[model samples]
Target: MNVTLRTPRFILRQPQVGDAEPIARFLNDFAVSGNLARVPFPYHLSDAKAWLRTRVPGLPVENSNFAIELPGEGLAGHVGFHPGPQGPVLGYWLGQPFWNRGIMTEAVIASLDWFFSASQAPAVYSGVFHFNAASLAIQTKLGFTQTGRSTLLCLARGAEVEHIDTIMTRSVWKARPK
Candidate 1:
């Protein structure tokens, strides 16, 4: 897979040693961490370092993550996937400062394009908290259909929240309007 993916206003690149600071900064926020299932509140520098240490730019999407960087801005967020029992699940987050900028939407599309072309998985899946309308809209607009519903324990929220599971099979992706 390519280490660096570019859209008009963003560059999704592999994380380097210097990225820990910015990543820790953005992820440390309650608003950001609250939406993520695994990320804890009060994110620490070590957490960012540990996360970046796991990024393998040249590895498969099932084992990599990217630092979402803007030209003048540093790290805007993260977008990547991890291997799971069900399939390859797509995950992403952006700094609160960068919200409402259509950045995540662009990032998701680019990530999906690369994901579908490179992996053997039959589909890509995403689970969004029911309260997060933005993410729900993003997934729907990108052609993901709800597969089911369940509850997930959110680290930041410290509770089991209603989660909507969605998937975009290879067939659905191909037949969608582009």
Candidate 2:
């Protein structure tokens, strides 16, 4: 869908055809791509275009994806959900230049707030590569608890990596301190 979520620092909107340049530029860095399970390293402009082509509007909220935009920076990151075997899986990434700014935490909070309001799903699933402490911290901060561990293929790394599975149940989310 054409949903636009706003945080105090940035806007989360549907990925656009025009975002290809920035998307490619940011994700091309191995530092950024390496942490993601699905993105390839040396990510190209064409790769960005191909990925953007799949971001069709009018999908259900459970399948929502967003392009995180900063006022002057164009696109700084992305945050979204995709269907997984267990449930709706949340995923996100931020450009290296924007790291340590807490931008992602804000974006995720907004996304989840909207998600829980829009869907009747029982929970949201997410996980981080074992080395991604920052991403895991974000999840725990938002009330997601560890469920177990598994291995996931890292497209950029070209290998399977240990993944820490986490979930946020609807009741847990509703009870979370705002």
Candidate 3:
């Protein structure tokens, strides 16, 4: 769908036809793919094409994806919610060049505010790989509490690895300390 969400710095908008090349460029990096479950190493143009094909523009918010775009850098990252067994699951990544700036956190906050405010779901779930301290911190900062752990397949690493699962209820979101 033609959804265009904005944070103070970036535009969370639809992934267009031309994003595949840049998507392949940034995602081909080992650092970017290592923490992800589905992105394969040496990512190809076809891989990007497959992902874009799945993301229909008009899909509802809970089932959609967005390119994290800056005015100058264009597609700097990606973020989105996918359906989970219990509720919606949050996922995101920023290219290595854009790391450590709190940009992903802002994107997550804005998207979830829209998700939580717009939907009637009870809560949201997220899982962070064991070594991804940054992602764990982001989820915690957003009030997601640890639910458990599991070994999930990693397309990049080509194996199942330890993942920390977390959940955040509507009440928790509403009561988050400002």
Candidate 4:
């Protein structure tokens, strides 16, 4: 899958070998490490390498994984979809330094557009930890609605918690402003 998406301030492209160090740094940030479900604290270069080598390629079983970059800056975030039984699950994370700048929101909106255009997915969904208000806000801004909730054990967090699952269907997507 050849996937490259652009927003006004960011470019969403495929991950390259060089992205490992930056990604590792992003993952190690306390703000990110504490909020995200799978990212480990004290994230390592080797961990980043393994993730890029294994997980990055499997992204968007129907579409692709994208490295989110600000123009002139290197990678600032990541946003993508993974195939699901119903449709696709959206996921994203921005470097802490870039938070509150609307960059992630822009990247996510562009990714959803690409997903709907490239795949047969009738809907896209994402699960946000209860405390991730920023992420919840971003999804809501993109027209995703709270569909349900579930409790899952987060091994990385070493706890069981409730998470809100949000979804946006094709019908709703088609009605969104261009």
Listed in order, each prediction's TM-score against the native is 0.94, 0.97, 0.95, 0.91
> Model 1: clashing residue pairs?
none
Model 2, 35-138: lDDT tens digits are 98999988999999999989886789888899999998789999999999989999999999999999999999999989999999999999999999999999
Candidate 3: deviation at residue 64, Å? 1.2
Which of 2 and 3 is ahead in TM-score?
2
* lDDT (Cα atoms) of all candidates against the true structure: 0.86, 0.92, 0.87, 0.81
* Clashes in predicted model 4: 0
Candidate 3 per-residue lDDT, tens place, 81-128, comes to 888777788889888999999999999888878788878878888889
TM-score of model 4 vs. true structure: 0.91
Clashing pairs in model 3?
1-57, 1-58
Better of 2 and 4 by TM-score: 2
Candidate 4: which stretches are off by over 4 Å?
55-63
Which candidate has the top score in lDDT? 2
Stronger candidate by lDDT (2 vs 4): 2
| Model 3 lDDT at residue 85 | 71
Error of 2 at 79 (Å): 0.1
lDDT of 4 by residue, 1-178 (tens): 6678878877889887899999999988867866666677778999889988865444544546789988778899788777655667887889988999998888888888888888887888787889889989988888889989987565457677789988999899889887
Candidate 2 lowest-lDDT run of ten: 1-10
Candidate 1 TM-score, C-alpha based: 0.94
Please give, for residues 1-178, the per-residue lDDT of candidate 1 as tens digits: 5578898888988888899898888889988898999898889999988976766556776776777899888889988988766888888999999999999999988887777887778998787998989989999888899989989899988899999999889888877777
